[model samples]
Target: MTQEQVTEFFHQQLGTNACLEAEGYTIDDPPSLDTFIDSYMSGQDIWLAYGSLPVLSQQEWYRIQEVCPQP
Candidate 1:
């Protein structure tokens, strides 16, 4: 993605994170823009909120995703 696209994607991810936090989920620190760019550009797996949170059952996970879909 272009720089602007990448930046927008980051903002979306941040918004999702904020929503999850507001729902009382623990969130891990997010990566820097540079790091996110590097990983995204290289096709590496980007860190996601669900990966950072404690394991949840399939139903709960789906519910949380409904509240905060991944960016």
Candidate 2:
């Protein structure tokens, strides 16, 4: 994805980020376009900025998905 696309994808995740935060996880600000592009070009996990959350069971995950919709 281009930088614009990457930025747009992050913008689109605001709702999901809020929902995840409400569930008690910390959300990191997305990387700058240059950093994102560099990481992606180097094969780093593009989702590193999002960090990780505690695991949830299928049903609980489904409930969160209803609100977050995973873009």
Candidate 3:
């Protein structure tokens, strides 16, 4: 999605525009979702999604751990 769309999505998902703004992100000039996801996959700390995956099934959690192991 476009930058503004991605920023709005994050704001809605995170329930706070201020959080994103505090991180030097603006809804008017946010990065694309694909870029953000790519950075996340590459272990860059460009974004944070707090409490978004609290209820992952056991198997799903294990699979995620396999893909992105803890330090």
Q: Return the TM-score for each candidate structure.
A: 0.79, 0.66, 0.31
Task: Kindly provide the TM-score of model 3 when superposed on the true structure, using C-alpha atoms.
Answer: 0.31
Write model 2 residue lDDT over 1-71, tens digit each, in one string. 87677666666666577778887778786666677667766788775423555677889778877766676
The prediction achieving the highest lDDT against the true structure is: 1
Which portions of model 3 miss their true places by more than 4 Å?
Answer: 1-15, 18-28, 48-71
Worst 10 residues of 3 by lDDT: 15-24
Q: Candidate 2 regions off by >4 Å?
A: 28-30, 48-51
- Arranged by lDDT with the best first, the candidates are 1, 2, 3
Tens digits of lDDT, candidate 3, 1-71: 65576555655544343443454444344346677656645676655443333566889667655543322
- List, in order, the clash count of every candidate structure: 0, 0, 0
Worst 10-residue lDDT window for candidate 2 reads 47-56
Q: Please provide, for model 1 over 1-71, each residue's C-alpha lDDT reduced to its tens digit, 9 standing for 90 to 100.
A: 98789878988888888999998998998899888888888899886655677888999899998988987
lDDT of 3 at 13: 41
* Runs of candidate 1 exceeding 4 Å displacement: none
